[model samples]
Target: MRHWIWVVAAFVAITPFTVNAAGAEPVGSAGALISGKSPDGLGTWTVRYQHFDGNSPVAAVINDRIDDAANHEVQHATWNGSTRRPWTFDATGTINVRPTTVSEIFVGQYNTDEPNMPMQSLGSVVCDSRSGTVITWDNLFQDKTSGLTRLSAEVEARLAPAASSNELRDWRRSGQFAPIDVNFKHWVATPQGIELHFPPLQFGRGLKIVTVPWASMSDQITPEFVAITE
Candidate 1:
């Protein structure tokens, strides 16, 4: 974790929002119907995000995703008082791939006053370096159907060792590798391949990563994506 990404903040007005296709990130609790309050005032949260050095739209999108991810504590935490339970949050991301352009990914986790509800959130976004448009799985491969089919097969194979439970196996087939936008939400483009981030709570225990290598899917991957990753 870089020092810049370790900085804490609160309700900062400049935080960027997510793109339409990227979808709303899952929050800790949303302060949802869950009643709660901190005996102490809402303690300040430790929020940190990956700082992009560039000013391009790609940078903007990544920063926004990080900002949104880090706020899960303040926006969704639960307790029973005027203020939500005291929670601390931290997030980090990186420009993992820059084939024809740049792409980024971010993940966050928080510790809270509530015992049962430990917080964990993961988010990732990839954008066109020039246009700034949110890029999806369909965009990474030239032939959407074949691309996904191949990627799906490859991803499942790689995750075989980690898919220890039936729940994980089902999600791997239906959700994680599904063409659904949210399914691939937590991912990054990498020169090595498309690296996935699966938070333990949802997938299993510790974080699990399964990379679909470019060499295995080169024939169908978008040329732009293969240029740098392969």
Candidate 2:
């Protein structure tokens, strides 16, 4: 717990936010879009950006919109070091649009009462441009039921060796494992196939990313998904 205090302190020290000295102005406005690209040209993306907005109702509405777009739940807590201050909402992410598909990734964090515990998670949304529809794991499979069955088996098999590892052990102890169905919402389209992003504590601290090659699941994949991802 002592160690966590330091961790939380560090996060607070670095998290960039504007403070109003007179407390008359809103801490910051919401609903800004930030865009960028990888230096190597591998990907280009945009972030639906916002900063900590002090308890303004307008800020709350903007926060809700950001949360809904990212498919994340709001985290509540007392702002550290200030009992008068209320919890604030801040979220940002990237959307990479390719010729065939679009991949969006969002990371969110909020202060919590637990020492060193900031509620944080990552989520992704992939879309097939041709159909102008969001792609789900079920959409990729010819036999959705059987395909999920196989995917679960394969993912478990791949992770079996690491069952005793610290992260997996913690996750298992916490009873968060759902071996029957793998979450497919957080994925990115690639030339190889699709890369899945599992956030911290789902598999471990830090992000757990696995590339499921198209060759491995070609039989199960629908032609439409194949055309988009490939």
Candidate 3:
């Protein structure tokens, strides 16, 4: 990770508690909305980053990681030079699952410009708001081996209905698709299901969400996971 050195000040905001759906916890704080525009002579670039709690020590862990990656892309663009001018980077965070039930699921939606197409990356975390600690991915599954296998299969199946079956077939055989790993390293848990993202051209789809519903995976998920998603 590139060590971050500040050239621009980021705007930070802490949202006060607000009403939420019945049985759900109050909507917790929103992240500091940090944005920066390149100074003169660097060419034109802008960055939008959020979902970082400037007040919490642990929040920096996730925030800095994403920031470094985003900055790397910004630097890459300046060096490589995209066909399109005014390169951009956005790393916005969302609380996919509210902090109502002792836990909250947050996902970083990162986008950066490429020569021909925009690139996407994901970072997801499930935090125990009560404990102020992150809930590791492995802890969610009962039988880790089988659960992961099932999850990987579900992800593959999600892309089956897309128009680019030929490309999908080749992708399945490629190194990126094989040896499927459901590390939960890149996922967002919603009320309806778990959404895993894949970037454009992967399946000839602009962007893809490989959603696996909570019901289908009930057998594999731990009781704690059940509670969180419920």
lDDT of each prediction vs. the true structure? 0.54, 0.51, 0.51
Expressed as tens digits, the lDDT of each residue in 97-155 for candidate 1 is: 36344454555566666665455666666656555556677777788877777876776
Candidate 1 regions exceeding 4 Å error are 1-10, 13-43, 55-84, 97-99, 143-145, 162-177, 223-228
Question: Best candidate per lDDT, number?
Answer: 1
Q: Give the 10-residue window scoring lowest on summed lDDT in candidate 2.
A: 1-10
lDDT of 2 by residue, 1-230 (tens): 11112221222211233324652222233333433322223223333543324375543443444334443322111112223222333446554555666555667665434465555666666656444466777677888877766665565566667667765666656644443345544676777666767766677677676776777778888887777645
Candidate 3 local lDDT, 106-145, one digit each (tens) = 2222333434445554445555443334555467678777
Candidate 3 has a TM-score of: 0.60
Cα displacement (Å) at residue 23, model 3? 24
- Scored by TM-score, the top model is 1
Ranking by lDDT: 1, 2, 3
- Name every residue pair that clashes in candidate 1: 30-76, 31-76, 35-79, 36-79, 36-80, 36-81, 37-79, 37-80, 37-81, 191-229
lDDT of candidate model 1 versus the reference: 0.54
Ten residues in a row with the worst lDDT in model 1?
28-37
